[model samples]
Target: MHCSVPYPADHPFPIENLPYGVFSTAQDPEPRPGVAIGDCILDLAALTRTPLFAESPVPAPVFAEVRRAGSRESVSNLDAFVALERSSWRAFRRFLHGILSREEPLGDDVLVPRTSPETQMHMPITIGDYTDFYASYEHAFNCGSLIRGADKAMQPNWRHLPVAYHGRASSVVVSGTDFHRPSGQILASPGDSQPIFSPCKRLDYELEMGFVSGCFCLSIGAQARLTWHHMQIYGGKATQLGQRLSPQQAQEHIFGVVLLNDWSARDIQTWEYVPLGPFLSKNFCTTISPWIVSMDALEPFGVGQYAHEPALLPYLEHDGGVNYDVDLTVEIKADDDEYHVVSRSSMKHMYYTLGQMLAHHSTTGCSMRPGDLLGTGTLSAPRPDGLGSLLEKSKLGREPFGLGSRKDMTFLRDGDSVRLTGSARGKGYTIGFGHCEGTLLPALPLLD
Candidate 1:
């Protein structure tokens, strides 16, 4: 189908990939739900006011909750809309495709120029909890080999389940938000016995993919049967506590995917990560792309998942091609330095699929909520150039990678900016997660 909106020739936000986001223009300063179409953003709030949206299958009540009473301003985030059932989500997508591709074009007021300086994108959803999962075999293996010998690389239980740590959701920021380098306790040398409190010298960015959870519902009966009507009526109340999700049931909980950068403080992590996994070293700041690519838009790019040895338990077992074949890249741009591509990888490198991760997450009967984020940790490819983080690319700072010829990087330096991007190729178009970017500011001054 052809799009009425005019976007660039190789635009990432084409008719086929109308990723959702929260944006505002100078004319309308309040943030509201929007979908990217070429260079313009279709304002859902405005569309609701028009006749075009009158016949849409998307429930009008959901859109009503977003705007303030008697005003066009959006007073809320996308938490409620994200909690809608899968059927509703599909119906809305189909409705959008029909109207956007029809011969009758939408008015200019219904669309905002996405490239305008007046336009700004914000965090689309109000995240409740964030979980970072070490689901990449290559990343885990590389880090393990660096610390331990190659023979003792992977932990025995690594292949058994999807290992994860609860991260600080409050610290999660949208793309383009710069942050100060975090300070923490670290050893001065490799053999140092005492630790010193200092600014992090080894700041790094982890190239990862994060899936946002939607549709909270309690599992009923021994088989965990879910009632679709409950979601439609109540609009997804929180999932009941002590409710477990099987692998087959986990797929429905995912709303969409976004590019995520789990910034790391390697030195701080080295000293404090012994007993507990990651603390302040990681919680400082996490960046994600503003636009979320829905599962419907990504279905065409499905690929076979990586083979897991020593077969997984029945609860965590899932069949079919759940993994996506999206190509990923990490780039670095420093002040007065040229932009350089640091590393290249793919989502296919993940050893565990997102469904497996979610199933394993709630295997112990943990409850889930809408806007819960689950990150697929550092999707590092097996090849050297395809490493996902500087920790792997630089070989634990023992080797420095060059960015152009004038500058070299062991880890991110102050004023250094990082950008992570991903794209799933289709017949004649591309599905992309708009850039997940962050610049490192100098650490705060030490107190006397």
Candidate 2:
């Protein structure tokens, strides 16, 4: 699995972890897709210049479509590429692995200068739809206990199905993008007669993992077959395609993983969310690591999906491991120049696996587009420090925690920065999503 690329022992990007992202250099401001390899970016646009891509067994119609339509030079947006079948994805990766090997058989001409101060990163995918799932056992339990009495913490249907809500895809941003604190109606005091419209009083971040959807071949007609890839590009309802996706079929549709920070305003959520799920409190911003580590790359670190206490139904059961043992960490940094690890947890603590989530989502035959994202909800562990959100850490602000600065607070303050990182260790490699980070800016003043 080794390649000639000079990856340091501790580097997040390795030959084995060729995560993809969209980037641009100062000289060429137009964004394009590139692959992370150690300190440098393997420019996909530049790769097309070489004979490798043309020589690979890329699906004909897909490649032909790209060539026929003079698109952007860089594979900058991976939406179209991700829609290809698994075989094509593997073929593309193999071609990359060989060229990146020590031999430099293709020569170093295609390499882009290393990512640095001059380079700019963009959102890797044009997310069509976003769904955030409350799939973690510890996170859901802790949040429930804090919000409701322990006696009635777990919702009756929580274990029976993967609880989720459709998220705002328009506001999803890449890492390092700062956003102003969201303003919303909040109850100034508990049991207040009326609510006040003001800035969020309890701004928080949810540490979670995100997965991107890819291509899936569907058995449509009795004698004919169609890949979900074609269905999406052509446009059709998945349910009309005639069959529900099995767990195994659902897993094949996963493209990759990214670190996700689902920003929340606790006060606003508490006031408004009763029957309906998250709305304004979450729509202001949702940040994600720019690079997406392909499912193929994460395969080596995969572990079996956790067993369901109340055995899952037949549709949710699958043949292989769906979870990866990725270590996730959240840190907060302030102007005082101090960095502190606020929480540490593993993705394996999730009660429902991504495959299960996908299967459940498609049970009704809902179509999943190439760039749709599914978020594994706040991945907290049973340990005290592993709590994922400030609501849990501060227990609804009754207690506050220190943030390296002299100030001990429950929620985020303006200028406070939050960063999340995730990685899974393999034989000699660390497969990781570089960082999902954001800084909170002062709330905007209201118009007169």
Name the best candidate (by lDDT).
Answer: 1
Tens-place lDDT per residue, model 1, 249-272, is 788778899999999999999998
- Candidate 1 has a TM-score of 0.94
CA RMSD (A), model 2? 3.0
Instruction: Give all candidates' CA lDDT scores.
Output: 0.84, 0.81
Task: Kindly list the per-residue Cα lDDT of model 2 for residues 1-448, writing each as its tens digit.
Answer: 6676676877889888899888888877888778898888887776765576677566684455333222474344776677666777777777678777746434455566666888789998778789999999888888888878787789999988899988999999999999999999999988896999999989999999999987665666322233644334422322333356777887887889999999999999988887798889888999999999998888877777777779877778877846888999999887586778999999888888788898888787666666789999999989999999888888889997677764577899898999999988877778878989999999999879
List the candidate 2 regions with Cα displacement exceeding 4 Å: 55-75, 105-108, 221-243
In candidate 2, how many Å is residue 77 off? 0.7
Model 1 residue 205 CA deviation in Å: 0.5
lDDT of 1 at 239: 65
Where does candidate 1 have its weakest 10-residue lDDT segment? 66-75
